[model samples]
Target chain A: MKQEIQVKCSKGNLALIRDFVNRWLDEQEVKGVLANQIVLAIDEACSNCMIHHHNCDGRSKIEVGLNYEGETIYVEIKDSGKAFPIDQYKPQAINDIIRKRNKGGMGIYLINQIMDEIEIEQQNDHFIYKFAKHLG
Target chain B: MEIKQEKQNSYISLAPIGDLDANSSLEMDECIQDWLEKGESNFHIDGQELKYISSAGIGVFISHLDEIRARGGKIIFSHLSASVFDVFKLLGLTEIVTIVKEGAEIAPHF
Candidate 1:
């Protein structure tokens, strides 16, 4: 099954994002570390949209979709903003990134580390981020 | 995020439990400012219960570093969970801020 939620890019939306992801994960009965990883990944993605993409303009919108299939959870976040340079944003190796303490660039890097798989693509003016993780 | 302040010796510790994102970052700023006005220089932030934090949150710490240093005070972090520690390490905050293993480690320095 799949669920979709649309949230506006505005302040005070992080809680809403967290609640939405947690509810979906609970309903799906995702347990243990897998659940925690998915929750954190979703939070990071939504935060990136709100902070980096929209720049807190409150004008852009983020569409989050969750899909449960067998033992895997798939999440996709689409943002209606300027295209994000996926290549430029490619995260450094975990050890290198962690050692440097690069503040602004750590979000995507952490998301990549936690999620099982991450694929980013740009279509027109929209940037799409797809993440997947397997449940135990 | 909810901030509960406790003063030990010359240090003021703010324990913020919950999400430390963009919205709550301002609240922390105000709390830090209030402590600064009271001439409280040293700070220890207990982030054990803080589940989430973002760049905006990190920015808050960076903005206050100068003030704390000018006053000859330091901000130390204690009891950060593995995930939260990853965020701090990734942002290179471990270099700029002093991260101790526990609140007790700060007592000796202050």
Candidate 2:
């Protein structure tokens, strides 16, 4: 089954996005811990879109797509703003972040830890972030 | 979201109930800022009721840590749920931030 959820680029709308993804995952009978992890990952993805690509304007729009096929769950987040610049991106060590008390890197870190495979692409006028997870 | 504030002699505890996402993170900051203005230094976040927190929520704590420390004050956390604790652990926040566990009181953390 496939479902799509859409929200404005505002941080104010993040709660609604989290709820929508959670409810959809719950219906797919995803376990609680795994479901919560995915919810976090999805939220981080949208946040990156809103903050980095759209300049956190909240005026632009973001869309998320959820699909369940066999034992895998796929989530895709699309933003129509500027293309995502992922070059030269590398996750820092956990100890380094702690020592520096960095606030910004945790979102991408959490997404990497929670999601199994992530693929980024650009098509037409939109940039897409796709996340895949496997059920236990 | 519901936030319960407990004022004690040595410390003030602010427990945020429900998901501490981007929206509630702002609310949490406002409440903490109010306490800071009132000359409340020691703060402990009772995380037992907080089932979830996003990166934005974590940012709130980071944004306030230095100010609290500059005044010889402390902002601590306690009784985090497993999932919430995992985020703290993952970010290595437990290293720089004081996290009270094993049923310990918040006062000793500060």
Candidate 3:
């Protein structure tokens, strides 16, 4: 199955993105903890794109694409905003994060923990963040 | 997100309803700040109506943990939906924070 959604780059749209992904996951019969993890990962990626790349500018847009093939599920987020190198980021240790009392840095960390594979593709005019998870 | 607040004994209870994402988390952060300004420290997060949470949502608690603890107070969570609890576990928060299981009393942790 394949599905896609386009959302405005605004913090207010984060809930909309989650709802869209959740509905698609539900239609695919993806339930339980695995489904929740996938939804969280997608939310983190899009949140990063909107906040860091587009600065939560409502004029910008991000496209979310989903595909389920065999035992793997693939997610792709495409946008024309500045690309953030999520794949190269080294997450801080949980203990260090607690010591620093940081609030905003954990989104990328959670995304890395939940997604099995992550890649960033820069095309001629846009960038795509690809995240995949294999069903056990 | 709507957070219902109540003072129960020595702790302040905040029950956040609906999804707590980046947008709504700001409200929860501000609410906590307000209580802290009033010298209130101990917190009990009733997650019964909290259906969903993201890293930003959890960040609210993480950011305040040190200050709350410095004031000799604690924050305890209870009645989290399975999915919400999974998010906590996935982030390794269950190790550092107190998560009271459903049907479990919060007094011990609080």
Candidate 4:
């Protein structure tokens, strides 16, 4: 099954996005820790796209897609904002982040840890961040 | 998200209701900052009411860990639902931070 949601790149819309993901996952019978992890990963990805790349510009928009096929779950976020190259991003060491008292890098780290596969697809006018996780 | 604050001896306990995502985390960050500015560092976060958490919420805690420790204070969490606790475990925060297991009192850790 496949589902998608599009929202303005405003931070205020994050909760709505999360609710949509959670409810959709529920409809797919993905619950408990697994569902929570997927939700967290999606939240991190969308927030990074909106806040870091688009500067939470209410004028910008982002699309999130969730698909379940066989035993794998695939999620994607598409936007026309700056491409963060999350697939190429090397998350900073946790110790370094704590030492610097930074709040930014951990989200990417969590996204990497949670998602099984991550790819960046940059098109002529937009960018797509694709992530996959195996149910096994 | 509404964060319920209560003073518990030398530490202040904060319980955030509902999901703690990117936007709402800013409010939590500010709450901690306000207490820090007022010379309060020790914090006990009650997670019973926290239904969901994203990395942004986790970041709020990590961002303040150093400063709080430097001030000779500690930030501890207790009463986390299983799923909420799993997020901390997933990030390996369970090793970096002190969390009072269920059925344990904050006094011992504090």
Best by lDDT: 3
Q: For candidate 2, please provide the TM-score of chain A on its own.
A: 0.90
| Candidate 4 structure quality by residue, lDDT tens digits, A21-125 | 999999989999989888888888888888877888998899999999988999988989457877777878778889999887877777888899999888999
**TM-scores, in order shown?**
0.75, 0.86, 0.97, 0.96
Q: Once superposed on the true structure, which residue ranges of model 2 sit more than 4 Å away at CA?
A: A55-59, A86-88, A92-103
What would the per-residue lDDT of candidate 3 be over residues A16-130, giving only the tens digit for each residue?
8888889988988898888989999999899888888888999999999999988888999999955788888888877777778888788888888889999999988899999
Q: Tell me the tens digit of each residue's lDDT in model 4 across B5-82.
A: 998778999999998889899999999999999899899999999999888898899999999999999999999887
DockQ for every model comes to 0.24, 0.48, 0.83, 0.80
Which residue pairs in candidate 2 have backbone atoms (N, alpha carbon, C) closer than 3 angstroms, thus clashing? none
Clashing pairs for predicted structure model 1, backbone only: A101-B91, A101-B92, A102-B91
Query: Which TM-score values does chain B get in all models?
Result: 0.92, 0.95, 0.95, 0.96
**Whole-model lDDT, model 2:** 0.82
Cα lDDT for residue B90, candidate 3: 83
Ranking by DockQ: 3, 4, 2, 1
lDDT of 4 at A81: 49
Per-residue CA lDDT of model 1 for A1-136, tens digit only, reads 7988888888677778778888888888875445655776777778777877788777778989999897888898988866555434675543343344333455666576677777887788787888888765
Clashes of each: 3, 0, 0, 0
How do the residues B1-110 of candidate 3 rate in per-residue lDDT, one tens digit apiece?
79999988788999999999988999999999999999999999999999899999999999999999999999999998999998999888898888887788766665
Flag the better candidate by TM-score, 1 or 3.
3
| Top-down TM-score ranking | 3, 4, 2, 1
Best by DockQ: 3
**True-structure Cα RMSD, model 1:** 4.2
Given candidate 2, what's the lDDT at residue A57? 82
